[model samples]
Target: MQNTRIILIGAGIGGLTAGLALQRRGFKVSVYEQAAQLGEVGAGLTLSPNATHALEAIGLGPDLAKLASRPARQAVLHYRTGDVLVDQERGDLPKKQYGADYYQIHRADLHDMLARAVQANDPTAIHLGHTFLGLTQNSDTVDVVFKNGARVTGDVVIGCDGIKSEVRAQLWGRVPPRFTGNIAWRGLVPMYRLPPGFKIEPASAAAVGHKHSMARYLIRNGTMLNYVAFAEKSGWETESWSVRSEVSELLEEFDDWHPSFKTFLAATPKDLCFKWAIHDRDPLPQWTKGRVSLLGDAAHPMLPFLGMGAATGIEDAVVLARAFQQAKSVAEALLRYENARRERTTFIQMASRAAQERLQGGKADGYTKKEHKNEEFLGLFSYNPATVAV
Candidate 1:
């Protein structure tokens, strides 16, 4: 495996995890990112046991726990009118259960941790500001072309660039992102400073106003409350991150809500609120093309409802690196990766879509929050790349 030289695009969780896992598997890996700076603007993510197992396999479990919260207890949901819809328990993870704890973390904190691990484990790794534009590969080697007029050679290339992946373009002619007719509004507020006399739920770091199709969570030791509000809409010209949105306009969407929810909206600063039109893609016929393939959102872009987008990508990275270690050729590794992951990730993508629809007041057969339990994710959670066989 040490003879393998892998080129990974995008320095997100998936890419970094792939680097750590491959390096641990005796494969040489280098990560590239288009961002000039490592700053990521996003709220916390719930890393269910499946993702936790992948992170632990990469050797960052202990440190990640320190940087994240495990939630004192399970979450309770309401329909914004103060009617309880679901009350579930948390914390029954076994040693070999999912192979890790269901850790929750701020996106930036998690990325920084992975970046630090990538650099520390291998000093001369992770090239920032190197944009991936194109690539070409012969039978024995691949040449990755970048926007900076530089070229890097490797044995295999993994695209973790994201939903609007350049690698996907390089593989299947230009496939644009499809707007899923949903508009998302998100903001973070200080918990201690939320409006005075606000009667908020106690188990709430965040809460969901089901009537408005919104959800919330907390980060930074429960000091900051992460708020996510959504509604059905259509046709976004561009699906890029960080779209501009006015707070006044966003607040209008929830103006007539419950007093507590309105109070929560009132406390959000104008500048902190940003909005984007949500999107996702249909599963591709194949994730790999020759020596180049996709990972993370590049492979499967799911709604954030289940919060498994990044987690699934992390799992893909670990499994891919392990598959390469076990297979005799890069082609075999590529095939093995798709074989081991396609169905599972496709299920998640479908589940995420189902969850989004259900939350939007749409009903469908065989789709229930009961089936999308924290335990169901344990299938992907319990997978450990070090000892994984296929």
Candidate 2:
């Protein structure tokens, strides 16, 4: 089983982590990515203790600590008045409760770390520019064909190709992802560019309004601040993450927001503003079929309200490797992986949608910490995917 050849579609965070974890377990792994080069877009991601624990299990604890920022606290504030509605201590609390530290890191940094780790294990592990076209699996082996006319046969195939995965289309038939009637604008600002005395007290803050909200947190070791603003909208349906939006348009959209929001928006680089439509899919009955299975967004894409998208993907990678280690055969391993993950990921997917409504349904003035349904409050951080029974 240690010599089983695993072919992974998509070289995103989940795919890379899976490749690395399987390699560490002595499995011959190959990761195929659509892009010619390996890199992640400029954005910030929260690594809850659940995700941090998984990364630590894969030997990235030191590197993650170096590249990520640890927020001492997080708060939810009123969008118009800037009054704190919820304030939670985070510095040593997560470590004490979950046995791991919560971290905020640049997405690119984390992706690069995982990619490099996978490459270090086997220089030929990651195959670039191989767009996954489709696959054909029989009783014994799975054959994945790429657009570049390359066909590789492996013992097992895992699709970590993201929400718009071709692998998923071929497996489950094409089903359009449902747009959640929400649009988001994102930008990054250098901390030095902000006005003097500008502070993100509590380190991470989310300003909630009626049908709209904005969240910001420090990343890249406190040198950069990442912010994402959300608003309820309809009809506009382009979901590309690279779609640029005018800074003036963004300012006008949030014209009635608090003055501090405008200040942070003004500090953001005009060329760096981008917007994308949020989309998610209903939970599937299963993630595995024969020797092929799905992971990450490909398996269970969810709204970003809970900030657990990437964390769940990371968790999947760790548990998958563990499943392979314990199972007797490829079929057993795939079944174990899906059975272990389906219930949890499904719960998170549904809860994230509920959170979006709770946070943005009504006016922010009435919001309170007691009513918060965030990741920590939901007991999501307590899951150590690395040690969970798979």
Candidate 3:
């Protein structure tokens, strides 16, 4: 493995996780990111047992626990009435049942932790501002050219560059992702901002209504409430996270909901909000082309309704590392990685789409069943990438 030099494109969760895992496996890894700096701004993510196990395998469990909040339970609520539709215990129950706990953490905190781990393994491994331009490879090695006119070479290139991946576009040509007709407004509010009489339970609560939904959960050790409200629309022309949204617009979208839900939105300290239209691609029949392969959103992007998007990416990193551990050659390892991961990711992709439909069609109960079913959640949560055969 020491002779293997791996190049990872993207500095997000998937890329950083893969860098750490590959470094631990004794491979030389260099992570290149298009961003000027490594940071996750104004977003949140849920890490189920499967992701927790993967992070623990890479020795970041203790750090993650400190940076994240564990919800006592996850409940689906009536969007207009705030009534509980379904409840699934989390916290110790998930840890007891699946050997790892479910956690919600600010995206920045998790990304920072992963960056720290990668730096500890190799201080100079991360390169910022290296936008991927294109790549060319021979039978034995690959050369990647960046936008800055810098070129880097490696044994294999892993595309964790995300949904609009340059590597995917360069490899498979530009095929645009289809918009799911849903736009989401995301905001973070300090817990102290809530009115004194307001009593919000410590749980991951999803308020579901006709063609709209809002999920509120705690992050940053319960000091901040991460809110994501979704509404169905004809289309959103811009698919970006930097788009500013007015608070009034957000309020108008959910005006008919429960007063308590509205209260949560009103409690926001400022008018700042970020919104993005959800877009996903049909699963590609293949995730690999020659020595280059894709991971995370680059490989498969899905709706956020199921909260498995990042978790699946984390799973990809671990399984990819496992594939390398067992296979004799780079090509063999990548093939094994895809063979082991494609089915699971595809299943989650379809399930999340189904869940999105159920949520918008006034049948969130169906999505809840999909979430609560032992076979569905367990089959996903209980997967141990460290030991799973690749």
The Cα local distance difference test for each model comes to 0.75, 0.90, 0.85
* TM per prediction: 0.90, 0.98, 0.96
The digit string of per-residue lDDT tens for model 3 on 273-378 reads: 8788988899888999889999999999988988888888888998898888778899999999999999989988888887765566776544455544432353
**Model 2 alpha-carbon miss at residue 127, Å:** 0.5
> What pairs collide in candidate 2?
none
In terms of lDDT, which candidate is strongest?
A: 2
In model 1, what are the clashing residue pairs, if there are any? Answer: 50-381, 206-216
Q: Is candidate 2 or candidate 3 better by lDDT?
A: 2
Off-target runs (Cα >4 Å) in candidate 1 are: 92-99, 196-211, 235-237, 362-389
Rank candidates, TM-score, best first. 2, 3, 1
Model 1, poorest ten-residue lDDT window? Answer: 362-371
Cα lDDT tens digits for candidate 2, 219-301? 97788889999989897889888999988878888888888788888788988999999999999997888889999999999
Best candidate (score: TM-score)? 2
lDDT: worst 10-residue window of model 2: 357-366
Residue-wise lDDT of candidate 1 within 301-356, one digit each (tens)? 98877778988898898999889988999989989988888887898888788766
Evaluated against the true structure, the overall lDDT of model 3 is: 0.85
Model 2 per-residue lDDT at 312: 95
